[model samples]
Target chain A: MKKDMRSGFFALIGKAAGIVAVGAGLGLGVNALRADGLSLGATRPTVGDDKSTAGSCSAGPTTNVPEASIDEARALYGKPGVTFVDARSRADFERGHVKGAVLLPYEAAAAAAGQASLPVPTDHRLIVYCEYVNCQLSSLLAQLLSQSGCERVRVLKGGYPAWASAGLPTGTGP
Target chain B: MGERRAANGDGAVSESAATSGVSSSCAVTRFLEGPIVQIAARLALAAIFFYAAIPKIGDPAAFARDIANYRLVPEEMVSPAAVMLPWIELVTALCLALGVLTRGAALVCAVLLAAFTAATTAAVLRGLNIECGCFGQSGSGNAVGWGTVVRDAAFLVPAVLVVLFDRGRYGLAKAIKRP
Candidate 1:
């Protein structure tokens, strides 16, 4: 029995090695034919593109939350302790932002531990926003907050521009 | 011992005679289990993985960045993972498609899908609104959420089916062997 098992193990490994060799050959052979060849560790994704024109944010087909309109955001902004988390850079935030909105950018969230630095009140509803409809940061931030156990996470519709255009209040610094 | 051997030989002869008169239903069953069905399954899985591998193989750096977006793998391992993953996909795809080591290839594909399902499930549970990157960079319209997880889960069925049904027939490996 022991000998049989040993032989079986060796046979399986041998077959697996053959399969790997074949796979490597096919992959590399095709890769070598490419115009660019194989480019490893070449570039990183760019941080932000402000030319967003989409109407809504989706985390994916699943875990999508209802979008909060500018009017809804304004209504919620006045209410005590409702968190409006800005998913923009600190530079962007310092230039101009919705009054009382906290800066918890998506790039920051990628590196930081879950909700560790943000002041997320347990009872508050978190409304996240970035640069208009095309900006994915807001959706990503909302998703992160939702993942971090925020029950009422929502993304602001049309993002910061809509709020500003609606003649709502704005702030800057720190 | 000779008497027993003669009796066994007679039993085999009778069994072969019985099987020679196979029913239409039995023939249909055999056809279903034969090369056609196996080949179709192999081609479908191969096409999918091949489509996935092409975009990633050329640009491992971009793929590495996509992997980084998931934050699943460690930073140091990301580069190596990115370089090898597409090649693995391509290899298994070729093996399965060409029927070269078909079962082994199917097993590899099954394992890859299982890993993808786990990763996507983790992302879903984590409330991540991210692209799946299963097929390189996700299109702008497609979000990597629960739908992606379900899709990956669905792809697993064929891989599992191939692994179970492969009998070393209708493949390049078998074709090359002279009868």
Candidate 2:
């Protein structure tokens, strides 16, 4: 029994090491390949050429899906299939918010998203907005949501400030 | 008497094997006995990847530009990575969450997180102020780095854990029944 145990331990250790090495190697190879030069890709994604396009922010493919234009989102304001995540403090959310937006404070966004019970369907669009761009909360919140599996998540550029500044309707806090 | 001695040796070998296997088998059994936490961990890891990759997948050029900002990878691999990595993440995350090919999916995640760690480390060491591009950054170009490392490390823990002990909890691939 002890002998068998010794062999099993060695085998497990060997397999674990091999797995780590292979995993790390793949990482470095990808990194090294990108380090070689990065001008062309298999297919360049289409984007708004104007870097200054309002109501639009770049969504990295791996992180989150691209959001709709403000105009498009306007139609989705309270619509189904669009999960509006309010990335603000609980107190602030209680002050005012958009209709149908869930109260997922930036600090709590990760924990909120970690749950499998949250009804936000995997196929729905996820939009995260915070008080303002200078706030630094929304960027983190958006990323957290994406990291947590919100497939089509978008950070409202300049966040809630832009929306309020644009005179969009604000909902009463819960 | 010679046959008896040989039998005694065989018994010793079997005893050693039993001792070793017992410990590991106990752990595996313990997990199989109560796998709720393991299931949660796998799902959590899957969620993070899905979230991380979706934004980058959407605007690959933005992702490419963010990758470029790091100055870790060469200019060439950037675009392909931008294009494929997200899809890989999306698929892997899906596989993990759905409980399909859990082990394979976890391995893919470990690979992604490990790459992220290296790239983030390289960028920081070189003093690049670039955004990690795990989430595509805006054209603002301010550079985002350190946080990337921390986030990747955070993800790495769970991914590695799953690779180590999690076989399949909630999704289609039950350890007793690998997808």
Candidate 3:
């Protein structure tokens, strides 16, 4: 009886090992087939970069804007076509923000982007910024704006904190 | 083969003893090993793996990036893993769902679940606040957390159960050749 139990356990292990081997073999075959036909190496645009939009989609060329320092952003404070978009949450936008920055919270992109009375046109420049350097919201918004036909979309360097530290114009609520 | 012999051996022992307590324990084991319960466990695990694999298979690049986010696989190997893992999942899911080689399929599921649990646990401990990426990247990603580890651990139960009680009455494995 003892011998039978030991052999049974071994047989079970063997069966499992066989299944795993077959599964792995099939997986490799499928992967090879996919790689042969498709271009899988194209990397998506990551945050914190200065490059023109690759125009991988239907929308025509939209320049990927560079990260702007506090000084550079201040220069655009009163520029005619530049718009500062707050990419933080609504609560954070309410607590403080760039004086004329409009709230376009990253998660609420769809509703805000779909608004009929959005301040800027598709061709206008959008300056997006979030909490700080580590935050991804600003970069994500920049990518989304560029994809949505915006002519230029730049992320604010150091985000809102750097701007606030420079004593640039600040506002609270809405 | 070995499983049948052990059952026969147990039968002989139980008959010789004829004790109420031993017989009751055997009865409970038999109930738990019933075909209906085993098949249900197999199908449940199959459904989860299928759902996870289908979306991932459609976009290998996105899945590759998600794998990179975990920082577990080497950068060069990420692409291959991204391409292959989903296909393996799909195959194992099909096997479990169809009850073909159910023991082997269950073992695969158990191994995958164990790996996921380990990865998710490590990510949480390291404070890597990234998407769990169990499924394909969605609009809002699930953050790596203790909850994710718990969920993966819970999934292992069905897989382990199927592996143990796989001699269930209903299955392609039985149809092909009765053990």
Candidate 4:
């Protein structure tokens, strides 16, 4: 009886493994057939890396939305056609943000991408930023903006925290 | 039987009546432990998995972004995980709903729920204010919180019940075996 029970347990495990294998095969196969299929072996580019091809304006895809260095962003600050867009949460935006930056939280912008007019003008050179260096919200928001016909969208390297730490102008509330 | 007991004594007749009462209660217990409960649990798990998986399957890229936001997995693995996880969920859900490979499917569901709960808890602890991504990329507003962790943890109950108590009753497995 004990031996039978043990074998039955193993059989159940085998069945579970089989299910996983089958699912993975289907996933990869279907993904390969799709037009928008992801390259499983390729690494996604880190947004702010200076050496990353993602920073090049001519990079092939929306995923390669260009990034602006802190110095570049500072220079463009308060320029006539430049707009700073905060891509963090509303709470985070309220806590502290780039001086004169408009709140366009990534989640809200993503949901309203094609349907609604973006908070920032599409004709403006939009500089997006989130919380910190590792935060992907800025890049993600830039992609959305780029797709939404905002031609000059760029992620701000090191995000708002970096700007603040560097003693650049900052603001709080709404 | 009541008449037979009555012939012995009044006290014996009462005991016989009590025995019948106990037997009726046992029937109720059996009903509660039977296929109805198992089927209900299985269907609930299947529905949740289906709802969660379909959106992710449709847009793996957005799902990949959501996973990257978690900051848990390495960057390269994010795409592959995003590509495969929804399909696994979908297959597991199908198995659960159809009652084919019910035990294995339930076990997988339990494990997935446990993993989600752990990931959400970790995010909450680290104060990473990100989307839960429990459902999919459309879950933009569904921020990760301790409440999200509790909800995922709560889902484990049905998954586990399906694992331990499901006997393929009223399922495709049982129907296939009928001669």
How close is every model to the real structure, measured as TM-score? 0.52, 0.44, 0.59, 0.66
User: What does DockQ give for each predicted structure?
Assistant: 0.17, 0.06, 0.19, 0.32
lDDT for model 1, please. 0.70
Where model 3 places Cα greater than 4 Å from the true spot, the runs are A1-10, A35-174, B1-18
- Candidate 1 C-alpha error for residue B111, in Å: 0.9
Docking class of 1: incorrect
lDDT for each residue of candidate 4 in A82-142, tens digit (9 for 90 to 100) = 9999988788788898989989877677556445666686678999998756578788778
What order do candidates take by lDDT, descending?
Answer: 4, 3, 1, 2
Compute the lDDT of residue B10 as modeled in candidate 2. Answer: 43
Best by TM-score: 4
Top model number, lDDT: 4
In candidate 1, list every pair of residues with a backbone clash.
A23-B91, A59-B129
Candidate 2 vs candidate 3: which has greater TM-score? 3
Q: How far is candidate 4 from the true structure (C-alpha RMSD, Å)?
A: 9.8
Over 4 Å off, model 1: A1-10, A21-174, B1-33
- Model 2 DockQ (Cα-based): 0.06
Tens-digit lDDT string for candidate 2 (A21-73): 44344444554565333345322222322122111223223443354455666
- Candidate 1's displacement at residue A92, Å, is 18
Q: On TM-score, who's better, 2 or 4? A: 4
Pick by lDDT: 3 or 4, better one:
4
Off by over 4 Å in 4: A46-82, A85-126, A130-174, B1-33
Clashing pairs in 3: none
